[model samples]
Target chain A: MLDVEGLAKATGAGGKEKIKIQRQITLPWVEAVRISVRNVTIRLGRTMITASGIVLGIAFLSSVWTSGVIQDGLQQARFEQERELVAATTRDQAKPDGGKTEDSAAVPGEEKQAQNSKRIWLVVMSLLVCGVGITNAMLMSVTERFREIGTMKCLGALDSFIVRLFLIEAIALGVLGSVLGTLLGHLAMLGIFALRERSLSVAAKMDWGQMLTYLLLCILIGTVLSLVSAIAPAVRAARMRPAVALQTEI
Target chain B: MAKIECPECGEQIETTGIVTVCPKCGADLREVMEAVGHERDERMKTIVRDDSVTTHEFIVRTRDLKKIYVMGEIEVPALRDVDLDVRRGEYLSIMGPSGSGKSTLFNMIGGLDKPTAGRCFIEEVDMAQLDAFELAWLRCRKIGYIFQTFNLIPVMTAMENITLPMIFAGMSTDEMMDRGRELLDMVGLGDRLDHKPYELSGGQQQRVAVARALANSPAIVLADEPTGNLDLHTGKEIIDLLKELNQASGVTVISATHDLKMIDVSDRVVHIRDGEIERIEHRADIDLEVGGMGEE
Candidate 1:
């Protein structure tokens, strides 16, 4: 019922009516919103620092993938150019261009081999980064909320409830990270495609289905990683006797 | 059906099909029609319309309640057959050393944890009989809890934290805001409604927490070491605010604390040690100056 300005006025006046006037001052919703915004900004800053490692890891993995794709395209183009020159030479030399011809088949095979190797290396690096990123993020989140997690369970929040909360947070982080990584990855890929004179078609665009599937997979991985990370910690937290939890120093 | 509860009053209703009215206090009811439609004698259908007074008025009661846990091979009894009664408008303190079951007792009383055995009755309603939903509803409306660490949602502002109970209860936006402001005023945090927990000092944060706890105007407030994080001066101020709220609004308060200064102001102090009630003493008798207590 009391307004904040009225409260300020009363405080400034410093009279016997200060108590009555202080009681009459009410904080406006705008002020509540402003405070919430400031708090959210701070929370976001903490979250961002924690999530930065994951984001950087994802960005690196995605860039490696993009480069691998570019390498594959370039190698294929070179292989095609080499095959065309070889075909011209064979024709001029009166040699038959047979599928069984060693020279003709060998060029394509070598190109395919190069592409396969590049893809394999990219996949392995990406997986490693993802695994590390997930593990790190989950560990940090669990450690940060160790007391809170314990308090929640002591307050009768079930294991499932705690798991859901962690998973929800993981999913939120995954979605945001995935989107940012994908966007930046797309732009990087687009730069290559432009250099090759390839028109930007919707097909060449980032496969959103792939993006969504990967995001969901990231969410699942992040959740599983969080649950795995939190399992020992959550149990530790849950088993913390209420007496001990209450006595815990922050 | 497990008839663990009363159909009319939500008590563990005893006695079946003999209801002329509530037997505890006879009040008129639209008489339940018998399945057989058997004609009753005129004397059997007596309805005393004047006896509307409720008989069971104790807000909380525990009778020989016990909670035992096994840690590996040893049996750890957190609470051992503790009997307690908390009446409306009475401020009581549960005081103890480190291993006392004060926190456990508060948790069970608020229905945040289940008792291992025996009965806990709140508002004459036995907690052992209610389902999860019923228990949640009871906690929603009947009890408010303040933890030692100022358990305001760290992500939220003071106002949002204060309104959390009503938010859980599905109150309308305007109604929740109004009630939140009222609570903020009651706890004397009207000016800092927009501040976050980190923005406020320890005492101010505790005040915000107190406002949040009283958001729904629950009949009982259970605080566990609310001053553990505060300085002596701030702690005293916080205790004074709690006392003022209890005095002004007739809300029953049960605080578990080691601060003897807090005990100095409480109406009664229930001392516990080794998971057992040592004694229940009125504040008028004990000087509370015998021990020098340190802040947690």
Candidate 2:
């Protein structure tokens, strides 16, 4: 860390007092974010296209989970009805077989469990594909903006700042797209189940709190997936040499 | 330019070079010319202060600078042992054909690239000694760059482009706006600040780039073929604008260019060829003026 005055003096400059030098200076974080926000908005078409991958991934994932919840609610409703009828018809017969209370909460057979796992596996594969899509989109974005990144670097933007710009973009898009996808998926699942069952009784049986938790989880997964996928492209953009900006110019 | 006078008759004589005898008075003038004519001023003196170069001495000094790129075990020497000195307020031009390493040397001087061997001192600070952040700091305040392609951010308005560097310098919004306006006005784009780069023509965009370069009042400006893409008339206009800016602010300008019109405004032109300094020509020694070279 050679101070400007010390450096000038050591180098024998007679005009040492004319300039001041500091070792580190960076664009304030708020300013960097502001610039990034404006950049995303200015290129909203590409942003939306990139974000659609996250939206679709989270949509499919939440749809499957929500459909399972709705099916469980419907099954529990039917089970309760059958148990009530059995108890009423045989009130005094060995205290209604003495085991229905414990059996009411028991999970379904292994066949259902196996089916559930298969559905979950399909959703997970789709999300992985979505992650790859986001990565490819981000890589394209980085290459397209190579000249801009170079200009920014030459204007004193640090490599970290460059990485920060991409991450901020990912977060904003991920959060928004994921939230929309979750709501859309849950409602679509609910609507289809309602049409098939021709009844609103399943809605009453559902624990809204549990459904909300899964929705939030799906949203979180979508956002995290985007960020993870963005890291490689963001790092690549940051590691770019500023000279490439000039050399790549048309 | 000393006018020698005959001591006996007090008659003035044109005694440049070896005019030993006065034409009118028939008296020897060698003694008088020797006393006043042979004195060297700061510009002409070859003064070396120890082994170090100071800013007041030369704003940019490179010693035995070298850069070699390795492309899968193939060693490509871009620049080799290039010793160059740029004076304060001097307009220096670097000329070489494609693949001649002229741009490589320019990048090294601008601190945009590092030399593999030896040192490049800018404002008396060795470029290799500065960390990335500090090197950026130096570039922000000390070196301004104008590209041949006029690399203004496409998304930003001309005003924003000018203020971009000021933002990195940590100037307040108000100060940035004030200085941005002043710089845009200096480049004759005061009325076009709101226009984006795409909205303007090639020359206009380059003008905005010039304003952006000057936003920080940097001590040196590095222009790489600034007028290479413009028409002959527009290119000359750009050159004149740079020359005027150079004369007005006394900012050292070093350009890598093939445009001969650039030579008209340059104080010195450095010719690089095959990773070495082929020759250096001062403005005084260049016979070509504006249009073409030689036999004129």
Candidate 3:
């Protein structure tokens, strides 16, 4: 009731004088929102560079999975060939035995070894490609933010805030790069499959579990590596004195 | 009020309320006013504390400090052992040459950098003992700073830059906007609140920086070469605004600058050289009229 009376008086006075006193403490937040948005904006392009590594990892992972599918098809084809040969020989020799030797050769050990080697090569190569690229990208990002990191420390920003900022940037990069790389890798796999068999949609047989695992692993690796790489620089920056940073010519 | 001869005409002039520069020739003010000596007795009357004291008194104090930088095996000492005290509502300036450690001293006082060895008391609490979060809280709650180059975030508008610290302080959006606008008006930049730093002149940019510094009503305003980037005329304008902030709001002002203009208004000047205090001079004790008149 007091507030309403004050409001009425304020209206008569023709200004903002009649609002509740609590309104003085509460202000419009648009400026804060705008500032936060700007901070995110200034960092977006640089953050994209950090994410590039994630994209590479995703692309390699998708291609390797697609290749594994092709290898499966090859195994099936070899089985079919062995079955046909066995049938022809058995038919010609007039000996159709009930023993179930359908298609495999007398020695299965060598065949199994060869298949294992191929799968091992694919998985090893994929891990190597992802790890090396992600590490390199992280190193570059840490170096680029050297001065800015120093400035923030001098301004009284805590080490935790520095760590959180870099990690968030890395995550954003990872998500964007992974999604785009997945789409591109899927499309490329389809093209390759069509080249071999016009009616085959081999790329459409995406193993969601496998893809999700690969993406999660790659992002986790990237984020961890980035945080690790940022540790040294962040410390250096946090311990930096404002006087020294301002005096720095760079 | 002390009396001193004018450096230009050798005419005796009253030291009290006398402009440092000669009325007739406008000679170098520091020299003209040197004869009066630092009137330490007069400093007692200028105290301007108000009702805003909260949680503490005497936000920052420094004693016998030094900072030495070791670069590739060379030990370069910056700040000398210096003792100073900044209470609420006082505006002080630190002036010296390029190699002089004014900037370093200011940085340590503001808790932006730690001194190599010495005691610094901020808000009656030992600065060296504060943890990282505690230091951050102190900076957020009790201190505001302006830099010479107008370190406004490039991508943000005048309003956003002013409100940047408030965001870190976890102020609500409404509060930040209201505070930001109030600051802009205080600095006479309300009309340019939406403009980016690039669009503003050097003076305007400095004004924006001042508004940003006051966003949280920090007890101390530490400015390092705040007017160093502006032209002479613009520099004078900035000085005027800083004076206003000191007089009107009672915000303690500490500036590190080579600009001689600061000597006129600063309450005290501590000369540092080779990482040591060569001399500590008060403004009132200078013999202002002892030089240049006879030579002329």
lDDT of each: 0.62, 0.77, 0.63
Model 2, span B1-296: residue lDDT tens? 23567877899774333467878878777777666443422211221111123345478888789999888999999998998888887889999998899889888988777788988888766777767787778777778899888989987899998888888888999988887876676555778879989999998898888878877777788999999889987787688767766765577899999899998789889999998999988776775454322221
TM-score of 1: 0.67
Docking class of 2: incorrect
Chain A only, candidate 3, TM-score? 0.61
Which CAPRI category fits model 3? Answer: incorrect
Ranking by lDDT: 2, 3, 1
Off by over 4 Å in 3: A1-43, A73-122, A154-156, A196-200, A204-250, B1-60, B194-201, B280-296
State the TM-score of the second chain for every model.
0.76, 0.78, 0.77
Pick the winner on lDDT between candidates 1 and 3: 3
Docking class of 1: incorrect
Two-way lDDT contest, 1 vs 2, winner: 2
Give the best candidate by DockQ.
2
Q: Model 2: share of native contacts present?
A: 0.52
Candidate 1 lDDT, tens digit per residue, B19-130?
A: 4455544443224323211222121122101121232234567878998877899989999999887756677999998778887888788776678898787665667766
lDDT of 3 by residue, B214-267 (tens): 776766788989989998877877776677667666777888888887776665
Candidate 2: misplaced stretches above 4 Å? A1-20, A91-112, A198-205, A245-250, B1-55, B287-296
